[model samples]
Target: MTPASTDAKAIWRAFERTARADPGATALSTPGASVTREELATLASKIASAMRGAGVREHSVVTLMLPNSVEFVAAFLAVTQLPALAALVSTRYKASELRSIWAGIRPDAILVPPQHAAGVARLLDIERQHDMVVPGTDQVLRLLCVRSSGPASVLDVRERFGLRDPGSFPALFKFSSGATGTPKAVLWTAANVGAAAANVVETMGLDASDVVLAPVPLSHSYGFDLGILPLVFAGASLVIRDGFRPKTILTDLVDERISVFLGVPVMYRVLNRTRLDQVPDLSSVRYHVCSTAPLSVAQIEAFRRRFNAPIFQHYGSSETGGICLHVPSEIALRPGSVGRAMKNVGVSVVGTNGGALPAGCRGEVVISGEATAAGYVQGETVHDRNGFQDGFQDGCYRTGDVGFLDADGFLYLDGSRAGVVNVGGWKVSLAEVARVLESHPCVVESAVTAQTNPRRKQRVIAAVTLHDPAEEAELIAFCQARLADYKVPRRVHVLEQLPRAASGRVVLSADDLPS
Candidate 1:
């Protein structure tokens, strides 16, 4: 399709048309089974029918707390088929976390996996006494349980909320991690999801023949946009994995003939340790994309050498979707760069004074484009009078990421905005230091955060998980060889495992770490 013909609205309309035209084509696959387009459409239709039957209406928030599987896909699409909004909650969340999220979102209904049905029921019962039905009646908060083998029982509920206009359907409700503060929900319209899918498909050069293996969960933005939606929109085959297992992924690559592999940095690191000889032929894979967090140059090179495929770096967030993607040419030129801004997207590095910085100057990275969110749900607006600013510009989301662009427009990430260690007058990016430390052969993973130091206002501290425990002095010497004197970690803490989010992002909150 031509560029103009491949816009978001157009692609989504195409998806609908294709579904009607060829319902029998394989659309999705798991480890042991697959779902054809016809089956997907039928299941989604049935679920939507159930929602309509349950009194769901336009703009109603429907919470989805299920694992990464066919049921999750059906539930998401089913919710979208109605005018009600869909909120994706991680299954990894504990009951306490779910209670907090429920209070915040005040969703009309929650679709829970059978495993968590009893806990969800108890939580809803507690909310019932408080009379906190923000969007609808108490009956609206019904649970749609999935049987192990038979059809889902929520068909009647969906039918009660059948939408007259699919265009008005609210796509998703994404919640930010409450680590920084109270968690906030981001509302995404069907139009927004369609646009994001189109951008990703075009940016990645995906086609019908491509088989995508998504290791990330559908609840996360990276997996939803970069993994699920793109393949569905392009009529490409989707191979869904419940979790990230290097051996399992390697097997899928060979068994499914997966052309596209999308994962986080940690996933790639795990895959690097896999015994390639034990897996089936993986030579069919084409592009392997990594996102969510920065991938080190060493890790990128190692992955490339092992897989013989280009490892592309992508940068974006939940609020903005995918704003930047590195193409093959750009990847070759700037090995660790997050490439230039995506097509139809504008990116800039702004200083503290709010002015754009020249190339090679470190500053806050900001982005503006069609794919950016309209606003946050019940929170601050994403854009301001200056065009785009919230975190960065008036309308532009302050990425909270610290980076600079080269003359060629490639972006180099230093660290996250919250990760900088302010030492007296200097700013040290933890990611930069951690990368250097992790390059050591014995180091498996590492995180750098600001630690209290009476001698100085704050000092850089490193928390490392090693394949084989190494002495602090050895680690310090390793960092000294690669990092600057001031940037080298002043204190080192060894841990067996690093705290991680469901999205696979390394959690580095100082309060969560052992003192």
Candidate 2:
């Protein structure tokens, strides 16, 4: 499809077209419930009607915090069908973390599980609330509308947040895992969302016959862009699992005849270690796509030996939907590379001068394509270095990833420009972890770094000089309270003094840190 064709397709409308074509086909399934294309569409329509009655309109922002269930899917579709932006928040986030993110997006409404309604109401100063039963499940969702001083208007919200007016209102809103201090809120226009889904369909060869099993959270960009979007654009079947259980996932792989599996490196690592009664034939599986973190050659080999399916590593960001994916046919030739750019996407390595570097020279990875987001939103300014150079339609995103393109155009990542460590699939900022540790009264200063373990991939390690005596577990527990579990250091070392250079900057390395 050309840019013009994709530009005309809205994400929700694309799903509607697919649903109309195959109304009886299974659109989504969970262990407890299932929904056909027609049923899911009708559910979304009903929810949209209810939202409209509650004063939701075009340009309104609705935050969704739910687990990976059919209700989450319907809520997302319902919001976008109204042409309102849907902001996805992880269900695992604590109230403190939620407040930090809400300060930027300032959602007009929030949809959460009934158990979380009281917490959300307290945070948003909700003026009205209602209990709504999810169509196909026993679950109940609490829809709360924030208190308003005057008439409901998107203009007031936009001005308050300092968001620019794109030609079209954005269809999706997401927050990055904080490259530095605070998480950055990003907005993607409907065209951008559609283009991303189209690119995945074209590149991954997805269709109505394929059944995908997604254990990852659909709220994440990895799952939303690849899992949900593909189901809508290609009319494929989706099997959702709330959490990962190796034995249960193994059984579902064969029971469901899943054709595609969306996962991360940590999942593959666990699966490799899981003992199966008997290895079942998984020939029905066409693609086992891994993203959110890098995969080691050993892990890839182990998976291929066990399942006879090669693991394809996908590389992208929340800002850019799907950049590079290791295609099945090219897996052997480009073993370590994240493969070439996805269809309709461009990837280049450029030096500081902004000129394209030679194939063998390492430089900043730049992306320009239909899948790139318009720009950062909420409190982030588009003029920053991370923002698009021109605009989403004709501009490029300077990805902070440091890598070089091979002579054959394959991309290999060396590292990121920022101080980030990948814990499982979640990106944890080293500076942020250090700050959390320093906040503890027992610590005078702290340094955090990433250490690679053969069994666990990458884990966060911290060293601290303490004014008061404290055990490593105590420090870790403190971090667990203040930060996300992934950001919490796996191990904490009590140090008398950290190695410093003449400039007084802590010079700490994983190798030099005490075990």
Candidate 3:
């Protein structure tokens, strides 16, 4: 097997060439304005030089929370020039969520939206609750707003900041969504980012001619790596939206002449439910890549039939950028597979004993090679229930997902090990059902789990609290209409209340249930 290709010069070299080759070509754009490659590079250089003057060194960690703005792209590209790792924090995160993440990272510098400055300062005051060093000018951890307090001196573009060794430090630090529980910070080295971008560019045949859409939040790894970073190698045009709205995106699909769309399953579900009288001509779109969460077969089929567009499944996590992407030509062969491991990456299925499982045998999935991150910060386990660990074993990062590899090497996910309930060889995801149930007006909140009955196998069960009185039969019918027959919960129990964790995710346990 070929070793992980960690050559990290691709981003710097590609950015320079793309800028010089066509100085006037648009590199990134929003509804407000556009920036050419030359202009973007110049802005990035200025930001990098300014950051250097603030005493941030190659080893310092910089956290960025600017979203859906041209400044974010410029700042991220500027971070590329410095050896410091840029951590992208979600702007949508609750104040408490942000505090939890920030307390742990204690970034050497933070770039927050100007409006959030006061709130963030309050969050820092709460930092005294955690065991972390508060950041400021006393050295490494300086905080900077996206908008400078006062204006500005332009430093030489050819400054010392641009001379740092690109491969000497990790390039990214991102956090999990914390949908299941507390979020964990994950780090990706320069090699990881470069390899992931290369894999995507190769698999999709994306190029300078392609116009990609940032259909999701740029702060999320989904948008940063898939939507933004891929442009480093391909020099493609990026169309940024203010935020995700069903009507706005549909309009852009036709108006932007977009060739590629980076989206998630939730977005597609919304689109499918919102029918179109004429499925706007999406002939220009070559790849409608979906990731972030698993896309159900019903959702996928509905989207494809309605739009006449191929909805390819992309499976990966914040820890590992793009593990599998369904290629267009191979779609017919492997209908639901996440596709094979990308170039310079390795994937294998492992049994309960941590032994390699044969083709078609479901087990925990483990991935390795250049595209995968080194590990989570401080070796913390992101998902404790999964049999996998944080770091790579034998160079492979044990993903907490359970799935089997076919003879063709296509990986099929069996849902997350913690979230998937096995019912006599059939797999059901609790997260999937929760979404469907939450759609019902009566279902104020719900939790899904499994319990073994006389059948000797686990049966799907959903516990729900209602806004108004609703019969169990009606709710079951509601799910039956939305999900696959097998995926529908076997039992829907009406509970007075559901237990919730600090992160706001429903906790499913006997102790938390109503008596």
Choose the strongest candidate by lDDT. 2
Off by over 4 Å in 3: 1-10, 125-168, 379-391, 421-472, 478-515
Please give each candidate's TM-score. 0.84, 0.79, 0.76
Clashing pairs in model 2, backbone N/Cα/C closer than 3 A = none
TM-score: model 1 vs. ground truth: 0.84
lDDT of 2: 0.77
Worst 10 residues of 1 by lDDT: 128-137
What is each predicted model's overall lDDT from 0 to 1?
0.68, 0.77, 0.68
Q: Candidate 3, 25: how far from true, in Å?
A: 1.1
**TM-score ranking of the models:** 1, 2, 3
Candidate number achieving the greatest TM-score relative to the actual structure: 1
lDDT of 3 at 288: 85
Q: Ten residues in a row with the worst lDDT in model 3? A: 151-160
Q: Candidate 3 on 259-328: residue-level lDDT in tens?
A: 9888766577667766566777565688888886556666666677788887888877777777888867
| Cα shift from native, residue 352, model 2 (Å) | 2.4
TM-score, cand. 2 vs. native: 0.79
Model 1, 405-425: lDDT tens per residue?
Answer: 999898988876787767767
